[model samples]
Target: MAAAATVVGLGGGAEKQHAECLPTSCSKHHSPKIRFPFRLRGHHPKNCGYPGFDLSCTPHSEYPVLELPFSVNVLVKNIDYTSQTIYISDPHGCFPRQLPNLNLSASPFQLLSNYDYYSDLSFINCSQTQDQIWIYRYRYQIACLSDESHQVYAIDSMSLPDISCTKMYNMSLPSEIFGYSYGPITFDHLRLNWSKPECGKCEARGKNCRFKNNNSSSTSKSQLLFNGSTECFDKPSMGAVLGPTFLLVVVIAIYHVYRSNKMKKADQVKIDKFLEDYKALKPARYSYADIKKITNQFQDKVGQGGYGIVYKGKLSNDVHVAVKILNNVKGNGDEFINEVQTMGRIHHINVVRLVGYCADGFRRALLYEFLLNNSLEKFISTDKEKNSLGWEKLHDIALGIAKGIEYLHLGCDQRILHFDIKPHNVLLDNKFTPKISDFGLAKLCSKEQSAVSMTTARGTVGYIAPEVFSRNFGNVSYKSDVYSFGMLLLDMVGGRQNTVAQNTSECYFPEWIYKRLDQGEDLGIQIEVDGDAKIIRKLTIVGLWCIQWYPVDRPSMKVVVQMLEGDGDTLTVPHSPFASTNPMPTRGTTGGRTFNSELEVISESE
Candidate 1:
């Protein structure tokens, strides 16, 4: 744990500051020392510790607590300043419970490298009866997280065991933990190491580390010192001894600064050029002031994503809109250009309307017509929500989304492929009409082109087609979107993420659904009426058809729309799509068919 470094002299003032920052602990005997680069919150001044290294004491237990990014607080067991390592344990005593949301990228510390000291561990939760039968076969069972009804265990294998167990999650842990032969896994503590502040060498040399510049104010000095501006010294006279070396360091620093500024200017020029070229699209451009007014200073936050935040706002005519403010745009502004240029030329009932855009300086935003209902994700995320929409409504939503994808693929003058199409991206209007949004990952190509060349895979993990990741599956094409829509339809029917392992040992849920349908078994869903059962079966069959292993084996969006709108009795179970074993027919057929025979002309490149 390294706190922000502070600039101080080796004289009287320096000695006073050091005395104030003297190592202290939550308890007199057991607690670890907290000093430079690590400070107790509310007890030490801001300059005493480095940024992101602040710790607090538990009110009742007196145990030191370290809160990581994303508000995860872990109890600090020990701090080895000499080794630059901090040992922590979950405050709730179950580290596995927090593994899903544990993020270390934003924090100063990092887990030990996976190649050397760490190994991957998969957690599986199973019923008590199954646990008893298989518990002796596995290495460790997390007793604290287990109960009478179910038991949780960790295994070294990446794939789930061939049994009725639900895969909870996966994480990397110390390699030594899996080697233990005797007892249950305690997960007693985790070791995290930090590289910043570089105080280990100073500690090894038995010398104190302090910021080199003593003339600046404490706040500014902390900022600079955190950027590796500190020096190792024993006394005030050491400064005079190191003056020449310091001067050389200053020269190198200046050169690096000049290069950084030059690069910034070049990036700015590229952004300006992009904005200028995009002006021809004739999208309504609003100033930053207008954005603030329209959003009421960003008061109503509607949603958030990796690229930006969406806020609910109103136009001058009182029409509601969703304003997405983009953040951390790259030097090329490729996403902004793709979204505006692609959405600007599109107008369809099932596609969200881009009302306007803002390119004020470095800040950019996209305005869209606000939908009353949030997204399709909210309605089909849980059992209750899924039932609230009923089987018929869910069928309609599936049909609407298919039509939207059909419009993007065939109706547009140029074909538009939505690389990312999941439940979250489909917004719902007041009438619950689905509108496909988020065109940042969309690609446009000539109508005659069948496949699009992709340098990298772009889409949500579970929803992405197999071809997008590798060429062995097939060339990337509009059929890729059909694969995603199929996954979405499965989620709507299953009322959960389709990628999750079902009751069976199979890793893929679609395979399980296919097996059930092949055996003519009920989908184990709560079907309110006979019609509901047919809708569920129909959605499942169509979804399985769309997610075929190869792009050629999957049906076109046009056929998908027809399947969803047509009677459920006419649909047929598709070939097993788990592996690239069975290739479906290329022409018109019940399972799947290509919409354009000319588009089937295969090539290495689009």
Candidate 2:
């Protein structure tokens, strides 16, 4: 009985440690407990806190100071976790001196002004005279004995005079603490409020929360999850003790059988549920026999990719359609359903329409309108085809893609973020009009939501936004697609053959393009003629604007469309889309290094 009790106790202790192991900063005196979204810099890893929430613990002091934007450091007095507010005070007890020309432009926090009163300070440089009678009405004067000519006074007011003060700045404070001042009230605290962390939602559901690193995966962003249990352990069963050797043998046998059966059942259930949900959607469903009849037994193979094979087909009414048969299904058919769910809800001229689907047992396929021009990939990847399509046609295709993406973002009932936006995904009809096709890696969310939590990285590597791979760049949002679109435009300018362009020894292709454009060099168009230079320049500039490192710096799809459609002469060159460490070479030499691959593009099955 003692041994059994000991075993259960150890198990419970392990569970407790797992749940409570989140990095924390505690205080011996007054500071509040700091954990997620507020981690001590050296004491915790960055994932344990929000991006800008870097708290520094002074060597021997119990208080932790938070550094806000513009390097303003404030000693944290108290933190209200539920309210997502923090009370801070000047570390040296000199509020006026510490907060001169204060600016919170770049920080995540906002100053909370709950009071009605405001104090305006006027700095004067004049001899003390009876004309300063109004200065007596205000609070104590701040002046140096050596500088008798200058006088400064601060007072609360609804309105102030247009006096000829040398300098002036205003400070707003809560009315409760705005007592009649004889001296500067330096001990008053400032309240700051931040939107509650996204992880808070996981905790609200009664589950333990932890940030998961997702660099190894290609589908989701690193975010919080409700996977771990909040409680230490489940209660052990109460029963008579059996012989140790006999119990151990029984447990081993049962575990092996249970694990095998659990694996089988889980996989089966996942596939069944996926298909059930796919059927519930409004799109038409076709049987395998019907798919074979439609495609004429896969006779005409138009394209083949890693995930599936595409064949040209025609319906009974002689309406031409393309059938994509998914051949290498990795797991439970989530990718197929993701495409179905995403493409079904969308309806736009620039967005490819999903006519129907085929999910007969293990055999699955998608039916789309047959496009004669194939993909933009063929046109951009080869020089002969690119010139044949001409720069004018390419510009229109880029505009079409932008319009499609804009409609996906704002025109829909819910915002659809296309994680993967590339040239191959853009298909052209017989008339050369482009439509966006693939949606296996799409995410949908409300229009009001600023950012979406992803479990792993999505989109191709060269095109992936910095924030999508690492949160240090910024939050992943609709702008992530903008970054990919920027890469797409750059690819268009480079004729798609020079994407990532390692042959030139350049770290990034956009840097190379920027140097050419800034120097007024021809973009090396194979067939440069009248008005061709302006169109190429417009695409390059718009692409650079879209690929800014920070999501905030990138323009929206609507603005991108306007830039593309408007006069190219009015457009300005954007900041070079290259990191400072890899500065552009003034000599313009490749240094003989070649070969570049950004996680290898996952080619769409036509």
Candidate 3:
């Protein structure tokens, strides 16, 4: 009986240890589960995980962080025991900055071999004067590393280019690093795998890998037992010991499943209720089968955005259309409801026409008339494309866009605020007429409402209004749309997005344009004719007027349309939009001639 008691005590102690080493996570949702060969350092016993696989929770964020050799720390995104792979990323959001000192040789993890090929890359920092020369020779310029006095570039060739540049560092990186020609180079996550203590087979069989005899010294030997001096054992089981506890878990699981089904049904009912009221709008509704037939199994993808992918399709009447298949998992049907409610009531020449919709089951899609020309983004991206559409045509396109925005604010029964207004959202027809599309982030309010409430900042970064990001700037209203349109016009004039400049010195393009105009200098852009120069000046001055820092100082779409329609002679450059001084009056004057003196003061409303 004494011997039996000793055995029972040992079993109880083992179970307690097992409970302590069970799977843990830094966050309930964001962080991955830490288990087996990979264990949380401070949360679990050192013996629970394999050597060189220890991770810890971040001090503030509580995110799982993996510390590699040389004190290089990366965020732990995921761990797959079955595949023996771990995904890690730079905690500071710049992997290239860490690559120079990243010494994976001292660590057990290695880059994924079968997935990607790697090459040695040398980072070179050169003087700013050599930028034009280097940019002409090498295409891979590292924007993050480049600064005011110097520029950084990555070269994959054997010898560095014959330029006056210093080699910053050399490291072996994936081949994809060389593929990016523009924008910042980034990796979503770096995949690594370990082969020291192979526990994949044990995991496949639903068993746990542990040191044989619970002795850490035996883990070094490869020929000791079932798995390289380690042993596979059944996971600790409480089902046999605690029947009532198991029953309670089962009941809780069933209740959770019931609750999930009830939630899904509730969502479905809400959608049905909206659709029943929306039927009166006269927009045709199609089933999922009809959607598939129209899209021909989504074969020809025309475009894709944050909301969904667009495919070219044909209706029963043989009319060509662009079908946007929205992401089903996006935002509990708010975007779909917004589009249906707003676009269904809207009818304007500048706005894209909504032909039909599909809300069959979980799948949702919106149909619109197919425009042969893609988006305004493609046209304004390069100077060659901008030249193809002469200054006069570009001016007309800007006017059309402003008119469209004006109609949305005044023409519709309820004011529609297009939160996202960038070149990508503006589609062009065969005649090159600009029509605003993508109402996914749109909001509707009464025409009398001057401002709107926003839980989060919406719209593309470069074109987003300052007020939309923070209320301290000003209240968000139709003026926010004016801000975006102003940025768009500036893009048309500059032949590129204003946010993306060649160097750090030229980072704020608007401020640069403002300074040049203030100094009585001609905008240093290619000018073919006097008419072209006048149009450029007009667009620039109007864009500056629209992008004032405060919403109260910005002109309404009504006033903006007037500015775009007027010839370039009378318009005067507005004050510096980025001025640190007190807010300037909504109306300004040059030579006692008021600039946009007709500007209306819109009261704050939500």
lDDT of all predictions, in order shown? 0.73, 0.64, 0.72
Off by over 4 Å in 3: 1-281, 316-318, 329-338, 497-504, 580-606
lDDT of 3 by residue, 237-326 (tens): 555434433443356457656755676767656544443332222345667887888889988998887778999988734367899998
Ranking by TM-score: 1, 3, 2
lDDT of 1 by residue, 151-230 (tens): 88887675456887888877777776555483477666678899988888987887656555533555474364345366
Better of 1 and 3 by lDDT: 1
Count residue pairs with overlapping backbones in model 1: 6
What is residue 276's positional error in candidate 3, in angstroms? 23
Winner by lDDT: 1
Tens digit of lDDT per residue, candidate 2, span 1-606?
Answer: 000010111111122222222334435455666665676654455444565666766533456777653335677888765566789887666655645535553356877756644444443334555266566565445433114556555554443455555445555545444455565344456788876454444445533334444122542322332121112123222232233433543664476467556767676565444333322213456779989988999899998776688899977443578898987665676666766766766657898877678767688899887888888888888677878888898999999999999998888656788888988889999889999987767777777646678879988878899888887776788888999999999888786544444465644457767777778786676655688788888898888878877676677787788778887777776656666733331211012211111211122221
Off by over 4 Å in 2: 1-282, 327-342, 497-507, 581-606
